[model samples]
Target: MASEANPRQGRPSMTSAMRSSSFIKEHQQYRPPSKPENHYGIDTVVEDLQASKISSPRQISPFNGVPSAENPPTIVESGVSHELSHPNCTSAPGTKYDKLVATLFYKSTSPRVSNTVHSPVRVPSPTRGQSPKPHPSDSEFPPNMSPSSSIDTFPLEPPASEPEPLDHLYGSHISPMCITSFLHLMSTFPLPPGTADLNSAHRCLKLDATHDYHPTVVELTMSPAPSLDYLSLEDLRKHELIYRFEREWNTDVVLRSDTLWRRYPRLVVFDMDSTLITQEVIDLLAATIQDPPDLGARVADITHRAMLGELEFDGAFRERVKLLKGLPASIFTELRPVLDVTNGVVPLLRALKKLGVKTAVLSGGFLPLTSWLSGELGLDYSHANEVVIDETTGRLTGEVKGRIVGKERKRELLIEIAEKEGIALEQVVAVGDGANDLLMMDAAGLGVAWNAKPRVQMEAGARLNGDSLLDLLYLFGFSDEDIQTLIA
Candidate 1:
C-alpha cells in the first residue's frame, strides 16, 4: 500500500512535493530544545558575535536582558567602539528567566556593577582602515580597584593656596582719603620703569571697631611691584609728592622697612628741653634772676631762636647761661617736681625698659635735671652740660664747664651709647623736637620729631603730632594687647 500510495503521490502534483520540502527545511532548522543551556550557550554565542558585527540581530548578547532607553548601562573597553548598544541590559524588556540570567552574569563577571546606571562609554571611534579594539577583560582589574569599591579612583579636592603678605598701618585717625592717597603714592611714585600692578591686591583689616583711638591701626596686605624701591621714611619727609600729600591730608607719610618696623630698638635717645619735658631748663633757670625781670623773657626769645635754627646753639646756649649767672643752685631742687613732664613719657619709658631697651637723655639742658629725669624714669644713661657752681655761694658761675651737648654731641652720644651697649647704630631711635635734634635724628636708624617746629618736622624721619607719645608704640608694630602687656 505504501508503494502504490507513494507512487501515486510521487507522480502527483508538484505543489505537494514543494510543501513537504519547505516544511522539512524550515522546521528542522529551528527545532525546540529540551533545556535552555542546549539552545543558548553564552560562551559559544559570544565567540561567534564579532566586535564589528555586535549590532547584528542574529547574535545573542552575553548579558541577556531587556534593552532600556531611559537608563542605559556602560561597558569599558581599551579601544573598543563605544557605539555598541547594550541591547540585553537587565532594564530592557525581556523574559524573567533572561533578566535573571543577565543579573547573575553581570553581578559575577561585570567589571562595573552598581545599583545606579552609569553613562554610556564615549570612546572615540577608530580611524579608517584601523582594526576594531578589543574590550577590556574582567581579569585585568583587581577586585578592589573598581570605582564602585575604591575611593582612590575618585577625583580628590585640590590643596589650598598660600596667603598674601600682611602689613600694619599705624595712625591715630585713618581716614578713607588717607588710605586712598597713601595707596596711590606707594603704587605710582616710587616705581621703576615698566613696573606695573603696584598694590593691586589690597585688603584692609580693622581689628577694633570701637576703641580709645578710632582707627588707630588697620592691617594692610598688598603686592607691590618687585622692582620699585620704597623710599626711606626720612626721604619721604622731603619727597615733593609725599610732602604735598602730607600737607594736604594733615598726615605724616612714612614708609619704614618691614624688618625695622618689627624689630624693637635696642637704644632710644631722647632730647631733653621741649621734648621729654614741656619746658626748657635754661629758660626755667633764667626766670629766677631778680636783677633783670626781663632776663627770662629775653633768654626765652633767644632759646626759641636757637631751637628754630635761626641762631647757633652753642652761642645762644652760652648767652642764655650767662644770664643765669646768679641763679641759686637751689633752683634745681625747686624745679624738680614742677617740671612739666610730657604725657605718655612714663608709660613709654616703662615699656621700653621692660623690653630691655637702653634709654638715655642726650640734652642741651644742664646735668641736674637730666640726672634727675634719668633716675625718675629708670633711664640707663644721662648726659648734659655741666654748669660751674661757685664754691663761695652754691650758685651758677655764668659758665659751662665742659663740651656742650649740642646737635653734634647728641649724634656722637647716640653712637657711643649704642656701641657701649653692644648694639648697632641701626638699632638706635632718636626722639626730639628741635632743630638741634635734626643732625642726631638723621644719624640714628629711626628719628621721630615730637610736635617739632615746622623745619624740624620736615627734616626728621617721622613726626608724631598725636595726643600721646604712646602712639609711637604703633609705629613699632605693637598692638593694643602687646603695648598694654609691655607697659603693665
Candidate 2:
C-alpha cells in the first residue's frame, strides 16, 4: 500500500511536468529557425534554410512533428548569440521569448535598423515560388564589408557654391602685370548712382585685354533709373569724376552712349592750326618777317590768348594778320613742304576714309594752308579765311576777304556741312584743342578735346590726354583688332 501511494503521488507530478514541456516544445517546433547574425535579412535566411533542408534533412519526431537538432538552439540579438537549452525553453516566460525574436527581426529586416534591445521587429512572408531579389552590394555598403554586417548609413550632402565678383573684368589695354591691382581698384571703385541695380545680374564685360596705363573702356550693362538718361550719366561722369581720374591716373575715362550714331559718325570735322598741324600757320608766317624780329613771338602769344578765349578771336586774329603785312606770297610755297603733320593724323584719316566717312578741316587759318593741308590729308572738304594778296607785288595786303572762320563760323560751318552731306548733327564728330572749337563741338554728336587747354578740357564732351590721336578709335568702341582690320 505504501509503494502504491508513492507511485500515485509521483505520477501526477511527472504528468504535469511532461504536459508543460511538451506544450513549449510543440510551440517552438513550428516556428522558423533564427538566421545567423551575419546573414543579410529574412529573405536570405529563408533561402539558406531551404537550401539546408535539401542538403541535410532533419528527422521529425513522430509524437509532435518537431525537427531534431544536432547542436543546441541559439537566440541572436545584433550579431550576439545566446544558447537556449531545452530546460530554459520550457522554464522561461513565453512573452520573454517572443520579445527576443521580435528584436532580432527588427535588427535584420527593419528599413532603418537599430541595435537597441526590445525594439519590435517584423519578418515579411515572401510569396510562394517567387525568387527573392538580391540586395545591391555596391551602393548600400563598402565592398570590403560583409553584407550581413551592420550598416552605419550617413546620407551624403553636396557642397555649397560661391558667388562670382562683379568688377573682376577689364579691356585689352590692361596689361597682365597690373591686372591684380586693377582688379582691386575696380572692385572697390564706386560706380555711378542710379546707373546699376545692385541686386540685379550686374557684371562688367571684358571687351579685350588690359594694360596698366592705356585707354580702357569698362563695358557695363546699365539699368539706369527712370529719370536719368545716358547723356545725363555722361555729364555726371565728366563733371564729377573725369578730371580727378585723369589727374591721378593719367587715364581718360570716356563714358560714351551706346548709339550707332555716336559709335559710327558719318562726318568728322577737324580744326586747323594747332590741331591737324604742329605749328600755327599764322605764327609760322610771322616768323618770316625781317623788319620785326619779335613779330613771331608776338603773333604766337596772340594766337595762344585767342585760343584760350581770353582775347576776341576776330580782333586778335586781324591784329596778328596786320603784323604779317608786306609778306611775300612765295612764303606759302616755301612753308608747305616744311609743315609737320600731327602724330597719328595720317593713319587716323586713312582709317576714316576706308570706312567711307567724310572728313573736313574748317580752319581759322588762311585758305591756302587749309586747302594745302586738306589735299595732303585726302580730306573731303576745306574752308578757311582767304587772305587778300596784291597781284602787282605778289604780297599779302593785311586783309582777310571772307568772314573769319571764328568760333561761331566754325559751328555754322559744321551744321552746314552736316546738312549738305545729309548727315544729322548727332552723327558728326568734331575734334579740336582751342576754345574756338567748343561751339563746333557742342553742335556735333561727340566732341573730343585733344590735349587742349584746361578750360577746353573741362567743357568738351570728352578729352584725350594720351599721346596718340589713334587712341580715339578706342573711345568710339573700336577694339584693337577692329582698328587693325580697318587700318590694314
lDDT of 2 by residue, 397-486 (tens): 998887999999999999999999999988899999999899999999888888788778878877776556776676565666777888
Give candidates' CA RMSD values in order.
31.6, 33.7
lDDT of 1 by residue, 186-279 (tens): 5664444443444332222224344553443443433332232565434544777665554444445444544532466888899988888989
Output the number of the TM-score-best candidate.
Answer: 1
- Summing lDDT over every window of 10 consecutive residues in candidate 1, give the lowest-scoring window: 98-107
Residue range with the least summed lDDT across 10 consecutive positions in model 2: 98-107
Residue-level lDDT for 271 in candidate 1: 94
Clashes of each: 2, 12
How many backbone clashes can be found in candidate 1?
2
Query: Candidate 1: lDDT of 348?
Result: 95
Candidate 2 segments whose C-alpha is farther than 4 A from its true place: 1-221, 225-234
